[model samples]
Target chain A: MTTLTREFTKGLWDEIPLFRIVLGLCPALAVTTTMENGLGMGVAATFVLVCSNGLISLLRNVIPSEVRVACYIVIIAAFVVAVEMLMKAYFFSLSESLGIFIPLIVVNCIILGRAEAFARKNGVLASLADGLGMGLGFTLALTVLATLRELLGAGTLGLVFGERVLLAQPFGFFQQAPGAFVALGILLGLMNVLSKSGK
Target chain B: MKSYLQMVLSLSLIAVLSGLALGGLNELTFEQIQINILKFKKIPAVADIYEILTGELSSEERMAVEEGLLSEKRYVDLGLNEPSLFFVVRKDGAPFAVALEDYGQGFAGNLGVMVGFEIETGNLVGIGITTMSETPGVGTRVKEKAFVTQFMGMSKDAVLKVKKDGGEVDALSGATVSSRAVAQAMDNARAFYTEHREAILDAVNETPGGSS
Candidate 1:
């Protein structure tokens, strides 16, 4: 149980997916145009991470050593396809909004990375805990970045559910490509500063 | 001999298991995937045109239009589904004019747009964006209702240039490429309408002509 706690907490900050490890960047940049998309992507990725990790851990001993990587890929791909199909059926608008990014989650390094580094070695319980923690960490990071971008770019927050808080006149540049880079850069800098300050 | 046999048996077993898992999942999701595809084909623009032209399209016509949207053969011939764009065109009740749209490749990704034009007069009745994937705050200004609304009633031959080029259109403040891409897509739709006017009209004029 103590180990489980450690595994989950580590992903939140100490080994943050986007800031510390910088995994799964394609969707990070592509679908994060709006706060809603960012949140949706984060949740979807988290679901894939938890399910794949748990399944992989269960089959760790069963999978042959020689073809473990291939097996892991198939498992991850299956989960991605499942998620994509489900999203399309139930959340058509979001599925459409996220577009190709949902299918592209198969290529996201974070899922494969966790499967290789943790799930393949850990027990089922430990792997589940790790998956949940890391997935949440990734989601949190994406949400922060997305919120900053959306708030500055559109001059509104919570545009997804139509809960808009008009903070200030939108700074148009914040919504451009350069804005994405700037936002990410400042976030990285801030994270580093906070970490160094022992917070 | 024993070790070699063990290796072969294990490999085959794994293969069989993996195959069964994947095949089962595929079978289960096949129907859902088909449904999603059908739903995608019935996006608002296509539905609107189909409704206007035929009062209410039967499920069969809808299925036809859905198939048409998914079919590569016709889209490739019309250049409507380029790597840069995906388009759908439908005629109104008179069958003399058709509304066409192109989803052009913008700076970041795709931009979906719709335009209605008269096949006979070559006049554009309306133009609007159904979707876009441009930079926020900057490129997304193209999606603004005001910006899209301006393209209404413009003549097909009217030079749809940005005001920077001494044309009537106003470019998005920080999204020149995206703005230009939208304009160019409209131009392509106009050219496509002109080039295929007679055939499109005839197709619309035929019984069961409307999109589903």
Candidate 2:
């Protein structure tokens, strides 16, 4: 139980993805234009990570080392397709907004990284806890980035906060591709400073 | 040899299981996904046609119109089992025009357009872009009023191609491909409306608020 707790808590800060591990910057940069988009993408990815991690851990013993990557990819793809279909069916608006990124989750390094580095050697419960923690941490990082971008880029807080505009003249630069890098870079610097202070 | 066989067997088994699960899920969600596309994509385009025909709709009015249109779904039989659905737009409580969806090969994929035709004269009421994967701010400008409004009140017999192709329509400055695609969809609408004029008329007449 302590092991499980340790595995879970590490993802929250110590090994938090994007900010710390830096596994999925592609989506982290692309979908963080709005808080709603970021949250939606994070939740979708989390679903895939948890499912794939648990499944991979369960089959870890049976899967031959030679064919494990192929097996993991197939499992991950199946869950991604399931997420795509479910999102389209129920969360149609969000599905439209997230667009191609949902399917692209199949190739996200974060899910594959956890499967290869952690889940394969771990127990199923521990893998699940690790996946949950990593997923939530990713969600947190994406939401914070998106809030900064949306607040400055579009001047609105998005659907969660009734899309109220907080800026008199929001800088449009923060909404574009280069802005994602700038915001991420600044946040990463802040994270490093805080971590060093804690140490 | 035994190890090789185990690898082959396990990989095949995983693939088969994943295939079965995804196939089942696809079957379950196919219908709902189609409905969602119609609601979110097709209906809003129809509402755009409504806005053009009458006037700008306030948010409340647009919502009410969309709700009414959803409940007023009508279909024209095109030898398909499910039949093709179309929306009728009313002006002054009378069925003034009918809107149907058609598609053209766009730069990225199929570009869907909801085309409105005047019922009395068969002239075009206007067009609305339904679904597009064109480049944002470039090719996507084909959906803008400046581009689409050119089709409004055009005669059915007029050639529906961009000026580069010897037609009257002017293409967007930097997005000739997407502009041509919208023209292609307009041409398709003309052909479809001509081919199924009788059936479409009958369907509209049968509608509760439609006229003979």
State the weakest 10-residue window (summed lDDT) of model 2 chain B.
B203-212
Interface RMSD of each: 3.3, 0.6
lDDT for A67 in candidate 1 is 68
Judge candidate 1 against the unseen true structure and give its global Cα lDDT, from 0 to 1. 0.73
**RMSD of every prediction:** 6.4, 3.9
Error of 1 at B7 (Å): 7.7
Q: Model 2: how far is B124 from its true place, Å?
A: 1.8
Candidate 2 C-alpha lDDT tens digits along B112-145? 8899999999999999999898865579899888
All candidates: DockQ? 0.23, 0.76
Q: lDDT tens string, model 2, A48-113?
A: 999999999999999999999999999999999999999999999988878889999999999999
